[model samples]
Target: MTDEVSISRRRLLATSGSVLAAGAFGGCLGGAPSEGGRSGLPSKVEVTMTSRPTPKFEPRLTHVAVGGTVVWTLESGDHDSTAYHPDTYGPNRIPPDAEPWASETMSAVGETFEWTFDTPGVYDYVDTQAVCTAHEQIGNVGRIVVGNPELDPDAQPALRPPQSELPRIARTRLEELNEQTHSLLSDEATTSTEEP
Candidate 1:
């Protein structure tokens, strides 16, 4: 009877130990944090879509800490948080370990797509959908700087994306936007007081 009890107790302990190990292992994986409170998933960052005097991301550049998430809320215009992954027809800029991820293209006002940056790097995204003929070529894009503010692309850390990708007007506009984002250059760099 004593031997049987000892065996039963050992089996229970072994089962408990395995369960605990599995739970701990899950956190180490690069998956989005399930227990955001316990696993250091920081509060989400938000960027709204704006279309009126200007058709662009409300905040073209976003900053977040590692493990932080960014949710792009579409206030207006058809948009998505399309990461620059091979699948998206651009070199990836997100962290090397991070998988290429994107929010579905949505146009309804108030629709949103969220992504967690589990690793550290810059994640450049674009809204490729055409809105009244304006498209990604016209500067419907944005970026999330994770952990490193001085971030470069994941694959070509040195080479920047070519300006030829966008229309001439858009390329110039995006350059101005990038300058503004890269530097605290101007709060109204993209904004124009002049009548369009």
Candidate 2:
């Protein structure tokens, strides 16, 4: 026999090249196989706010860890996300009743909101609809420093109003210094009523 039929075709091509190298090493270490083949718990962070170039509110600095859970997805226009506790959210700092841990109003486009901090602190938010007219009084604002690695030395530092109530820009030398302090208080009350 031809040396036992060339050693049985070299043992059937080395057992079909070791079964095609173990099916390419198990498909490069087992990938593409989820549903029921089970293996999915990875996205511990994802913050999106789409609508290309015009409608804002993307990432805007979002990070999670302590208890972790922030799933805000409003991929287009129309938005809302109140959460103002850092002293009434903003401008003139509105802390009278301060109630608003979650208030996803007007969430039209795609609409999705999910929050879960599990106590750490500092979670100011905004965007209560009028998306642009003053856009939450300019800057739109957002901050959620849960599990505090920093901000929260007794919090209250997000919108520290008191710079003469911040929101200015109407000057002609501040309107001629308020008309020379109203013409020196009407010439000091007409020279103090001719001195008594």
Among all candidates shown, the one with the greatest TM-score: 1
Ten residues in sequence with the least summed lDDT for candidate 2: 34-43
The digit string of per-residue lDDT tens for model 1 on 23-132 reads 45322222233433432333456788767666677567665557787777888767667776677646554556667776777878989888877776555667767656
List where candidate 1 sits over 4 angstroms from the true fold. Answer: 1-42, 149-163, 177-196
Cα misplacement distance, residue 49 of candidate 2 (Å): 12
Backbone Cα, N, C clashes tallied per candidate: 0, 0
Query: Which sections of candidate 2 miss by over 4 Å?
Result: 1-67, 73-77, 80-108, 113-121, 128-132, 138-145, 148-156, 159-196
lDDT of 2 at 13: 99
Estimate candidate 1's alpha-carbon lDDT, on a 0 to 1 scale. 0.59
C-alpha lDDT (0 to 100) for residue 45 of candidate 2:
41
The residue pairs that clash in candidate 1, if any, are none
Q: What TM-score would each prediction reach against the true structure?
A: 0.60, 0.24
- State the TM-score for model 1: 0.60
